[model samples]
Target: MTLELQGIGVSRGIAIGRAHILFHNQPDVREYLIPAFSIEQEVERLLDAIEQAKQQLKSIRNHIPANAPADVTSFIDTHILMLNDSSLTKVPVDMIRQRRCNAEWALQLQRDALINVFNEMDDPYLRTRRDDVDHVVNRIHRILADQEVADHEIADGRLKGHIIIAEDLTPADTVLMQHQGIAAFVTEHGGATSHTTILARSLGIPAIVGVESVRRYVQDNEPLIIDGEAGIMIAGADESTLKEYQQRRIAFDEHISSLSRYKSQPTRTRDGKTITLLANAELPEDITTISNAGAQGIGLYRTEFLYMNRLAPPEEEEQLAAYRDVVEGMNNQPVTIRTFDLGADKTVDGGRHLTQTVVTNPALGLRAIRLCLTQPAMFRTQLRAILRASAYGKIKIMFPMISTMHELLQARNLLEQCKLELDKEGMEYDRQVEIGAMIEIPASAVCAEMFARHVDFLSIGTNDLIQYTLAIDRIDDTVNYLYDPLHPAVLRLIHMTLEAGRKFNVPVSMCGEMAGDPRYTRLLLAMGLEHFSMHPNALLEIKQIINETDLSLLPANTLSIMEVSDALEADMLLEQINAPIIIKICLSFGFLIRTDKRILII
Candidate 1:
């Protein structure tokens, strides 16, 4: 009997192999009163465990293959830095001494506290960071419990052709398994944005996460098939099914290999329309990947990472250096640096200490432009740093979450103030540095024309726009189903923003997951989005889709989709828009076609 299970696919590909179950049960930790005399000894035990965890991560970092993505090393570096943070090290020791509790219990308590902070973060990407904290804390907990904290290694290439089934995976474990030549991995727990999942994508491995009780039915050594694109796992497959999947695997591999040709090719549509494809960057390490992907420029460079995991905000000089590195790395390519988008409840000392309030709904509470306005001093420091870096490269400043003209003006006013201060100090900077506004909120999307009048460009951030327009938490598993980018309301808002940009003669770009996704690439082009920015890994694939698209054939079909109220009907129309040239010609010629369960005649 063939059995199937569904999960969240984070990385795309196909894998067929026997199962390799890796059971990593977390050790139980209980609190008990400790004698005052042993308090120091208990604290010392925790310090030692913390030190061991750091060394282990360092060792893993050292062992990462040289051919691996640069971000791979950065992920391990994040874990090591978390281990060294005072919240994990000094805070736990203080808890042990103050509460006279066991080291394990103290560490567990601190872990819970840290996770709670992460859970309250408004950004889905930031919220998933709690998984990193959990991975780090669990390492120390295992060490304190005298258990093996390292992943068990098989010396004879036993795992080379095996599919790893696990409760979850840390970035380190994922790296080690990839090095050992695992075929793919499926986890019972993890989100799409977790560091482990991101690493899997970067390493070009087939991976699915958030499958429930996957190990319960998958026995060790059972033959299995994983479709990472569909988030499907199959067991007990017959010979015919195995043959079909083998053919699919070959075709998929060939398709991936063919994407490299688009790296140096121009992103022009079949009808001769040139599209500007850019890459969204986070850290300076991404510049190399962006360049290799042949991105025209950096469309969105998030600045929040500089303020994370630190007691104080980065001073002007440090930020200037980091921005300068990215600007220089791009070698004159335009870099749009978005101001920090931290929320009040975010786990950063600068944000929490300044806000000093427990926000019930951080999503709707103080964040992004609101937080920046509240902390003018911090905001000015960032503006000055950005201005200083503009002298080095083609830099643009973008403001995030600008819901109202008042907020936009307020932010722009501060930028003007920073410019005047730099001028007074005789600083060399770009006097005409372009400014843009991110249309992520419904209010901003509705009033985009007004924003366009004041800024050089408008970039739609569909991740937050869809979430806000649909009134759903994108990261909440229960409500996330309602988060739809294809929703009629969302499409209308996007269309309105694009129209507004056109009316003002301002360039419009999209910098969200939707921009990178191949499924909606044609639809977006028809809707008048000229610029697209996404992860560097997705650049080549998106460029390929753009090169094959014919803009002349899309507008009418896309307009029909926009007017449809039913999501299924819109999806069908979108499929027709993206169909192959033969199918499209048939549709245009009034041919009847049966696809799946639907029969349609044009």
Candidate 2:
């Protein structure tokens, strides 16, 4: 009997191949119990592992197709860097010596520390890199602990006459499979935003993650057809289904190819409304993604990176150089630069100590503009750098956390201080630079009208607002279930903020994960959201959604759902509406989706 499995649909495409397990996670040695001179020995071992990982990464790089996309190269290059970084190897090796533990044990400790860092990042792109970091270190730890290099890739490459099934895949491992012609990939863990999913999408391969116990169903060499797009898999000898799927696959490929032609064009709806799309980036290198996507601007340029992955704060000049490059890249496009949003969980190296002995929650802890307001020097320097760079192109400064009127005033004061200092020193600055505040805090959301009066614009940071309002840490896997985007509290806050922005005649944009979900596009538009900022990759797709949507009825549809007492019902209502037609239907009637799950006519 074939044991069918289910998993989250990540990448789209079709494939059929054999079961091949990439390398198992490296052994997890908690620590070493050795005699004297143990630290020195562990250091040497780490060095050896570094060299080995380098050689392995080099081999992988060499095998990648010359025509392989730039992102593919980045994945390999980043893995190599992770393998070589002293932070991962050196510090852990030192810890092993200090604690009299083995290299595996030391690595385990370091892995814990690295995870702690990933947990601190507020930026999504930067936060996602943590997953990459975890995967890399986990692999290294397992490899060293297990003392094995399974020739899985080599064996499977030759045995291409089979299907691919596994528990889950790291982005790097998935890329490795691609080089081997593994055909299709299925894993038990991953999401729509995972790196593996993104790679598969970019590479035009079929992949499914979160499918459970797939190995129990398929024999190692069974012929299969994986419907990655629709999230289905067929095992062996279904000639009719196979033929039908093949035709569907062919059509899908043709359609995607057709869409590729619009890769460089502005996304306009079939009805002729031009939409603005911007990319979310971390490093300067990501600017290429913006150019490739033809984004209207850099929707979110995370500045936390300038603070994270290092022992000291980035100097003003260093920041200026980085900011100027992005400015130059976008040329005329606007870049919304949010301030460094550090919370109690994210401590600056030797800069600040926790004032509160123990805060129940750090996510709602002193973070973002709150942290900056508390640490004026860092805040001032960042402001100066941004103002200096603003002279290069269209740039707007946005503060991340502004709950009280004082925070906004303090932030503006800092901005002014930076400008005054720059002026006194004869440094070029954008004197009339516009400023905005992220309405992430409940206090700010409730008083958005007051906030609107103080800033040029408002951007709802749904990621934080949802977490704060529901008191759920979205990052904590254990309690993430409690985080609900459809919570009445969340809807009320968003609506109130958007309403405030509209009333004050200031633009309101959403720069949160919710903005990226197509399912919520109609709901958000219906909420009276005039602007949407999301990951640049979604610009065209979102534009497609926007073009097809009639803004007039979305509010009513949203209100209609809001009238419902059950969150499930609201979600079900949203799911029932198709993406392309939801807008047309809304515009046909002046309806809005409300917080109470009931329709309200405009």
Candidate 3:
């Protein structure tokens, strides 16, 4: 009998191969009283393990294929940096000595403390970072316990065509397995935003995550098929099932290949409505993919990376250089740089600038514009750097998480102040740089028209908009099911923002995950989203959907979806909106005929 399981598909593709169960289970750790003489010895053990873990990571980083995405190497670098941090290295050693405990137990204690801090973080992205701590600590525990590290090389090439089933995979493991030519992988744990998932998408590997207890249903070397788009894994399939999937796999590959034809083509709907497709970039290295994907320009260049994993926020010159690289790299393609969206809890200067008071919910507390306003000095530094970089290329400034008119005005005032400072210093910059605001908060969306009157453009950040509107943490598996982009309220907010843009004659764009998702491309287009910015990998596919869409037919259907209160009804309407033109026409005829019959009967 065939067995099937469902999971969240982070990447899009299909794979059929034999199962390769790769376990990276945490070693059971036990605390033991250490003799006074052995206290120093116990600390040395932890230091040695840390050194080994760092070496292993360095080796893996060195062996990473030159063709791999820059993010792959960056992930490894992060792990190595974590190992070097005093919290992981010196703090654990101190605990081992102070408590007179085994090295593994001390590390475990420190890991729990670190994870508690991350768990209390309200931002989903920051909360998920605790996984990195687990990954790094697990490696050290395994080493101190004399167990083999999980990221060991598969020298015999036996996993070349197999599907890996694991409890969870670290970024290093994903990168290594992909290098060995693994067909795909599925994990029993992970969310869509995990580093492993991000790496899977970047590596172009078909993967499914959050499949609970996947190992219980499958045996080693069992033939398996995984549909990454549908988030399904099938084992012990009948011949007919295998044959069907084989054909589907072929078609999927062909369709992906066909998307390349649209790389240079204009993004226009069937009715000749032109759309602007842009790429969201994190690092400067993303420029190559963004350009090759034929993005009109960088829609969202996130500046948070400059503040992350550092002791202090980047200096003006340092930030200018980094921003200049991307600005010049785009070769005059417009780049929209969003200011640092960091929270007070996520201080870049090692808690030197963080509030002493406990923030129960960092997401709702001081963050983004609020945090920037409180720290005017830091905000001005970034604004000055952005202004300086504008002289090098087409640059636009964007402020994140603006919830009220007051916040918007205050941010704009800071920008003006930065401009004046630069002028006094005789700095050459783009005085006409376009300024924009992000509509991610419900309040901001509701008051979008007021904001549109101020900014040059508006970008709907649906990721946070949906989360905040629904009052659920999307990264939380328990309530994440309630996180729906098609909810009546979410659509209404989006429509309000779009309508506001139209009323003020200002351009509106979407830079959230919704923009990259092809499933919502037509609905968004019908709702008047002419500008979309997403990951570079998703540009071509979204462009394909846009080219095939007929805007003339979508407005009525989209409006129907917007009017429906029930989510199910809205979903039904969305499907109709995305249906093929022929199918849609037939449905329209059928609806009209049914209405005529009802009228005659009445």
lDDT values of the candidates? 0.88, 0.70, 0.86
Q: Rank the candidates by lDDT, best first.
A: 1, 3, 2
Query: Model 1: clashing residue pairs?
Result: none
Per-residue lDDT tens digits of candidate 1, residues 85-170?
Answer: 88887888999889999999988898898888888888999999999989999888888888864444333576888899999999
The digit string of per-residue lDDT tens for model 3 on 113-226 reads 878777877667667788999999998988887886554365457789899999999998888888889999999988888889989999989999989899998898999999
Number of colliding residue pairs in each model: 0, 52, 0
lDDT of 3: 0.86
Higher lDDT: candidate 1 or 3?
Answer: 1
TM-score of each: 0.95, 0.83, 0.94
- State how far residue 98 of model 3 sits from its true place (Å): 2.9
Please give the range of 10 consecutive residues that has the lowest summed lDDT in model 3.
593-602
